[model samples]
Target chain A: MPVEGYAGDGHFRQTYNDIHILCQETAKRIKTEFNPDLMIAIGGGGFIPARIIRTFLKVSDSPESKPRNIPIQAIGLSLYEALPDTSEEVVGKEVIRTQWLDFSTLGDKNTKYGGLLGKRILVVDEVDDSRATLSYALQELQIDVEKQLKELKVSEEERSRIREATKFGIFVVHNKLKPKAGEISKDVAYFSGTDIEDLWVDYPWEMPDILKHDELKRQDDEMAVKAK
Target chain B: MPVEGYAGDGHFRQTYNDIHILCQETAKRIKTEFNPDLMIAIGGGGFIPARIIRTFLKVSDSPESKPRNIPIQAIGLSLYEALPDTSEEVVGKEVIRTQWLDFSTLGDKNTKYGGLLGKRILVVDEVDDSRATLSYALQELQIDVEKQLKELKVSEEERSRIREATKFGIFVVHNKLKPKAGEISKDVAYFSGTDIEDLWVDYPWEMPDILKHDELKRQDDEMAVKAK
Candidate 1:
């Protein structure tokens, strides 16, 4: 499934330590499964992923011990013409390169193959844009949808829908800024942007669901009444 | 002279930004008279001096450009045995090395030269340690006392006292656990540490002495009567 949402909220909004922990987990996963020649990260905010990868490299003790040769590279991809005025210094210091690719450049020729063809690409965004302008571009590049779906853990139903909708392509629509009808493909999955405030609120509740169980609730209520 | 105290409130302690402003102002006065090759920063928090130096580098546009140098070397002298556990990552990333030197290391003839000897040191601390063990160590290093005094903007009377005291040789009392007692020496000059609550209380009254001559007090009396 295409994960989309604000990273600062809910399950995504993570602390530096938390990001480090996730990196450790990812490093373990990579060690177990595929050791692709190169790991390509595509996103604007490159610090988090790059730091994670760096930390992983620091901690991981692969028998090969060839970290210097098999490097994890990150390339920033953005839709806007101008670079976003964010923490560029921090990002520049961390990432290899910042690439700007305009989706409009893909036109009818197909976008998938234009940049990310056979490369194992990791697509990151606040939300999944159904326009598929970026994803379609990748698909045209001869990227196998089945492989990507399996890797990303997308449900079989979602994979079937994506394969079926490959013909017409996709379009972009904004809930707040409504687009014309048929502008976007309905078959593609959409993820709501994660907001920081919402993440702050949801993080505590995301703890084991047992905290919300009837027994816990009754005990909490009894304690409160007794204290009162 | 060593300066200390919290800013705004005890809860919201003063930071490097606050100290940098004052350091810059002091730098302006002595910039022409004594061009410093190195700045020896003594106790505050490690971050504050690091920031002050960083800020200085930002504004400094001299031919030497002291700030941009890779090993922007400086010692962070403190009475504390260990440097406070802060995100030292800031120093490493910025490529600025703020080396920590314990005050206890001073006065041992066998010890290598550590404290500011001939360098135009900027001492930042809450209070002066009259016992002078640390100061004597620096003096033994053949540091130009006259030059240091001038850089510190010491008054003539203070200069004489420091010169005479140094002749006899001074020593700093070892009091890591408890606060030490001692007024600033003649060689030292004071910088006011930020106290926001005090500023809030004193600012209005600090207006022109001429304005305080008559009308303001009458207005205060009338206001007091109205409250009654």
Candidate 2:
């Protein structure tokens, strides 16, 4: 529960309030800069922040009417095996699932409610560790988006144009400063709430004894203050 | 965003800390009473608590091994016209999705991970206002579970046995104590974190101004104290 191997009060901890603020602050930039149409949250860890940030991402053209919530799709990702940095992803099929994802609910092109055709998609998670999971998500999403384009009976030029317009962005509460196992290209609009040295930071959700976790976190705060 | 027409400063606000504790406490009972295999979260509102509760519901077979996090399926649900108390629901297809849920990922009966065949299922949401959404979700899920049973070419007795074993439970953070628009049968094990009068309650996730919301919540606390 408290991150497998390191299962005690020895790890760095964060309060629920801090994480909520991080998501809120980052979402301000995402609304104006990225302007995503939909979001795909990597399950479990990403679920909390993805829902939190959506409150800020809501769009209301006119104040009189209700603000529209950005629809979010939560998906699962598991690493097959460590691959070479240059090699293409195996594209894990067990989780991505061709039965759905841009085929049924998300793929219905005509419906104003559905369709990922040329819409901007934001991929969210709690942290960017090795980035193996993030890389897998981005790769599979790119394939799915292209498949949606291919199904459409349109000219090659138009298909390419729509493909280009269908942008992808990455957002995570914490982006670790370390060599990643997977690589992300510069084309995607990447946004991170904050960057920190690679450290074991326990999310509030993972802590079974939250009060004690907060007490330890407070001690850390005191140490930093004393050092200063 | 703040529960439609009942917006602005006129709302009962809850802090993030309070909600987290509510979920953790409710989860303790859910763990003993109705141990769920997989969760189906009524999306947007349900997403937050569903994720939070999963953290506590996790099972660690051994201390050395990591605790298994319950997989969650976030789904969309919208009402199709207000039906009479006894009238049947016009099952909304734009959202229910036949392609997924107990069909693809959840339906693969052979895989230990997938099947909804005879597993305990938990349907989660933040608030149960009219019970329309929860009723809709339970009906669709019941239909889907039966469909899974029908697909298998088994004897009638065996099918009935499997159906009986499949249990369904409901969990919500807040339950408004009033006559609901939709009806829920007595069989389903229901759990709500707290019950309040039929008033507009503002969840932290929906707030645009969280600080102000918390401050108001603090005032409510003070008022409650003074009244006592």
Tens-digit lDDT track for model 1 on B1-228?
111332222222222122334445544443444444333332222223322332332323466543331011213233322222221111112121113332232222321232233333443332222323234324432354455456555578866655554321111111122232322345543333332221112111111231342244445445546655
Write candidate 2's Cα lDDT for B149-198 as tens digits. Answer: 88878889988888888889999988887788777878788999888767
TM-scores of chain A across candidates:
0.35, 0.82
Worst 10 residues of 1 chain B by lDDT: B198-207
The 10 consecutive residues of candidate 2 chain A with the worst lDDT sum are A80-89
lDDT of 2 by residue, A134-193 (tens): 887888788877767878788899888888888899999888777887778788899998
lDDT of 1 by residue, A119-203 (tens): 3333222222222333433443234444444554457786565555333211111112223112333433332222122112212
Candidate No. with top lDDT: 2
RMSD to native for every prediction? 22.8, 6.9
